[model samples]
Target chain A: MVPAPLPQQLADLSDLVGRMCTHAAGSLQSATAALLECRERLALQVIAREPELDALRVETEELARDALLFHQPVAGDLRSVVSTLRSAGDIDRMNRLALHVAEAVQRRHPAPTLPPEVRDDFAEMGRVAVALAVKAADVVRSRNVVRAIELDHDDDAMDVLHRRMFEVLMDPHWPHGVATAVDVTLLARYYERFADHAVAVARETVYAVTGEEPDAIPI
Target chain B: MVPAPLPQQLADLSDLVGRMCTHAAGSLQSATAALLECRERLALQVIAREPELDALRVETEELARDALLFHQPVAGDLRSVVSTLRSAGDIDRMNRLALHVAEAVQRRHPAPTLPPEVRDDFAEMGRVAVALAVKAADVVRSRNVVRAIELDHDDDAMDVLHRRMFEVLMDPHWPHGVATAVDVTLLARYYERFADHAVAVARETVYAVTGEEPDAIPI
Candidate 1:
């Protein structure tokens, strides 16, 4: 059977990327629930699903390579394929970061990785990260440069939350020992990086559609 | 003027990636010095040089795109260009992770980020990361599948160092407290990620040369 047209292939690439982003978001949500509630089963589920996202990334990249090989697409089409290739990597990284969160939950086992004082902060971080991933999926599907650029602002919220986590760790009256502090520090970094990858996906989408850097574009 | 032949252009791409890896290693070396010595000037210098690596990444990618556009390379040539494109990104991230180490130094300014107890551990980590980056640069330049495959084992050293940092942090008698523990955790992550990117560059090199995933290759 003749392969779909280049445009159809490109659209399929976008859909694949969107699915990866959504999957990453779901994994992160589950991982966060595991962290906050001390649920090893949920964390284990998130960990088990990691290879699924890795497979999706490999499939997306193979599709992109084939698109480049067969279509020899130029200009916008070339940009779309290249952008999808890069975005798949970013989305896969988001999944890996979520896996790290899940692994943290497993490492702590019956004990919660997050202290009671900072549970709300981590819950908020997890919420914001999932939102960014979901919005990043929308941006990939829509290629709406406006919404894509808005992801940068959305990531600012994540940065603020990351800083708050640090503040809690640094408080002089803090009771959690160095071990919990290390856990919180690494967990915060994972969520921050997850949001960063989501923003990276949006940036790739913006670049794919406009051939302009997302930062240079007027929001 | 006539453009270089496709083979020549591919060689140029390899050279460009090699330079990026070398530059990244230098930045990490300086950043590590800054972190261990509390040398704000060195940290600032590393910070100032970030745009240089960023520009190099853009130039490498543009060259890769032009090769694809004009030459329309097939098979191995196509893989070479694609692998270089991905490796450029990994090397750029190596530079960014180095910059994070520098920024941590600047944040802690007058006070050294590493406490005396873990100072040697971080210094060792810094050394291992720089060695990995330097070896990765060699791998990019040589495309020696054997040497490229060696980088994974090299990264195992980095992994050991990373775990050691956590051990120091988790020690019961640790006196650095949460604030310093937070700094150490992030700084350790930066070094670990820098080494990971170096290994990723090697994996790309292995794939480019052998058309086989690095892990799948018999080492």
Candidate 2:
């Protein structure tokens, strides 16, 4: 049997990456729901899915390696393979970050990980994070440089939410004790990092298509 | 002009990666000092050096790409170049994590970022982080699987210090307000992640040499 052409393999790699991003988004969404609603089942589901995401990442990377070895692709094709390899790593980290959020919920099961005062803030942060992941999947699937560039601007909302969480945590009137403060701070960081990885996926897509760094491109 | 052979190019790649790890170790040490002493000059120096580290990572990645293109090495040589590319990214992130620590110092300068109670803990954490980076440099330089595997155990000390910071923050008699707690939490995370990147570098070296994941190798 003949091997698939290099372009076909590259396309398959992109499809796998897009699926990984979608899975990551679902994980974050479920983890956030668990955090807000104290749903241990949802949190556990996210945790259980981590191994599957890891397997996907390994598979994507191997496909990339084989393409390089068998096809010895040059120029744009080489860039796409390299970018796919890096983007798989980013998407894998996104799932890991989501798993961290789920673990936070598990640690505080039956008790809300998010405090009442900042529940709305966390809810907003979660929405923004899920949106970024969804957009990242689109960018990976379509290789739309314009949409990829938009992810940077889209990430501003996550940043604002991150800073807002810190402000709420540091308020003089904060009633929650140090333990809760620590949880909130770490949880906020996880969501912020999840968004950052989504942005990184977008940047990798942009570079694969344009041979230019996302920031260097005139938007 | 005669281009260097594949073996020589691979050796140069290893040397470049070793330097990157060493540079990362130095950055963390300087940043830690800045945090401990509230030394704005040291913090500024770390910040200034970020571009140089960034440049080094780019050069390392380009060299890896060029080697793949020109030599088209197979088997272990190909693995070495790919691992070098990944290790350069891990080292780059190590430098970025160190920069975050420096920025934290800069933000809280003239006012110590660490409270008196947790000052010693931060100092110890810094030491462990630097030691891990230095060891990682040696492991990358040598490609000794045994030494690479040892980094995981070395990281246990960092984890202990990280948990210790939280214990201090959560102590009922804790005097510092939420602001200091936030700063300390983020700083601890930065150091922990820096150590994680060091461990990752070691793991990559192990994979390049053994064609096996580090964890799968029986000690």
Candidate 3:
């Protein structure tokens, strides 16, 4: 049970965590934006921002942990704060991964051979990655379990999409050659992990409320 | 604060969520088993087990959520339960993703031109996936924050391996066209995500201990 005397502390902690989630989510968005727009400057900025977000993650996690240890909260309170702390880490890593992709892309501009048929295929991967990060942030701040759950179903599509991405790269007729193939490899990874991490944030949210481990769930 | 009357409930809920996580981690291991031994039956089993695990996730999440609504926990309690529930989805998805690769690998024998290489990569990826999954389980059950924090660094290696796997695929001299390419895509996604979800799990663990986000931490 929430201690009647602790409202101010709870609100402060929640707000700080909420901001952490928002910033982490913003980093994800910036990473994808850097990718989609091919803005080297933006990509650099995203990469630069990585350390700050990482710092925030560590900071928030420490605070939550300290609070948990010192206060030894009730079942519900303990679960929520602990998960938030955990999700912050998830959010941070996901953001860093996104930044990694942006930098990888920036370091080597490997434009995939767009056989008119594969027009938006690569772009779609970037879009999805950004979308996943955005959803993860929402899950953290709002703790919307249903929204969090959506990440699971949508992730299958990521598998499917990346498979298609490879197919396009492997096509012998593709004129761009190895560059297209290499680009597919890196970009596909970014999207794959993006979806995976988003689902991670959601899993934590569900855990926050349910105290259930993710392994027990139906796949 | 820790509720005076909820210790039993806390233990019960933690045990339940921990069970789910344990199974989810096992599923990842089992799913990888399909590739390590190249046994189609093993792969099938992993897929078959997914639905059961999925069901567990849903049930536990609902339970945790109900608890949250019914009883407000203090910081530590909230973090514990919430991290468990949150991690459940990531672990589940990781299991499913590994199984996705297993299920596909189960479908066909690799072409001879490079079956050995593909097999090697698959086995390695599976090993990596299982390693991460196992560690995640350890983190949750043992409440090991350092191990959780270490997961972030591990993902970087996963990404490196993914790129190396790609190099093998694009060498052109490697032969066994089209199919090997597909294998690379699938295996790459699986390994990459395995690392990612592991990082997510670790992040949550750190959060459970410390209130910092990734960007905020010095690590």
Candidate 4:
């Protein structure tokens, strides 16, 4: 096939990022579902797919570097290219976090990591985390800054859930022993960090569009 | 003062990356010291310096982006700029991992996280982690591909330590409670991940110098 024009190549790159984002979102969703359901097969699938995400991340970085060298795109175009490159790292991190969740489930096998009392809280975390991942994918697909900007609120919710999980762990009356508590703590962190990466993607998207960071957003 | 030429600017950028690497190394060392000694004040100092790392990271990234737009360097120079940008992220992550170690220490102030039995293991981990980080910084400063390539071996040692830690955790006679186990798990992860980031910087430095990834290096 004949190579397309530079603009077309740029579009292809953006599309590739979108596809990767969708894959990341799917991975997190499936990983969480597997964790909740104790499905080893699903969790294994998520773990296996992580290499694909790593490959895609490498391709994205290579393509971005090539575009910089070949097109020398400047200003907004430059920002967009940089964002595409940087966002791949964020997406890849989300994929790794998802894999961590999957591995946690796989480690416990048929046994659920979460206890009965805290299952609902983690379930809520999984829901919000998957939703936030999907929203992040949507932002990449549409390049809609408004939707991208809304990710922070979802991320904040993830944080609250994270804190609540910690509170449960630190509670004096906590019934779960150290092993289960450790699992829950790590699981909570995986979800929270996943959400953090999603928010990072949003921030990069905003920076790409505006050439400035979101208001009061820390580096 | 007059702004430096592009060559000088590029050198300045690399110097900045080196400075950031040193800071990251220092943070890891200090944080590990805090963990080992259970010194709240030292841990607090490490936490307080994290913002400085964040600022340095942002500055390195900006300098890299600006250099790209203004200088449009190609080939090795372009790779250098990109490496500096990417390596800054690695360094920043290392700093964050260090902060986690420090915070873990601060949270359990006046009491060490690792039990008497595992304290020696973690102390060894801290030592290896610090050494690996220093080696990574040296590679960055010198752009020595051979030295950079050796980091994988150091990283391998870290992985062994990490696995040894898990072995202890999973042992039938393991005596530490879940909270302490969780703390040790996270601390081990922090060290292993810090080493991983250092290896990443080494890999990037190798690529920057040779324009090719090291042979047989698994992604």
Tell me, by DockQ, which candidate is best. 1
Local accuracy of candidate 4 as per-residue lDDT tens digits, B53-83: 7778778777888888887889988888877
Task: State each model's CA lDDT, in order.
Answer: 0.89, 0.89, 0.64, 0.81
lDDT of 4 by residue, A1-219 (tens): 444556766776777787788788889889888887889999999998887877777777777878888888888788888888777877887888888999998989988866888888878888888788788777876778888878988688888988887777777677767667767877888888788878888787788888885434553
**What's the DockQ of model 2?**
0.69
Off by over 4 Å in 4: A1-6, A172-176, A214-219, B1-6, B172-176, B213-219
DockQ category of candidate 3 = incorrect
Better of 2 and 3 by TM-score: 2
Worst 10 residues of 2 chain B by lDDT: B210-219
Order by lDDT, highest first: 1, 2, 4, 3
The chain B TM-scores of all candidates, as shown, are 0.97, 0.96, 0.84, 0.94
iRMSD of prediction 1 = 0.8
What are the DockQ scores of the candidates, in order? 0.78, 0.69, 0.15, 0.52
Residue B62: error of model 1 in Å?
A: 0.8
* Superposition error at B54 for model 3 (Å): 2.1
Pairs in steric clash, model 2: none
Worst 10 residues of 1 chain A by lDDT: A210-219
lDDT of model 3, residue B210? 72
Q: How many clashes show up in model 1?
A: 0
Report i-RMS for every model: 0.8, 1.1, 5.4, 2.0
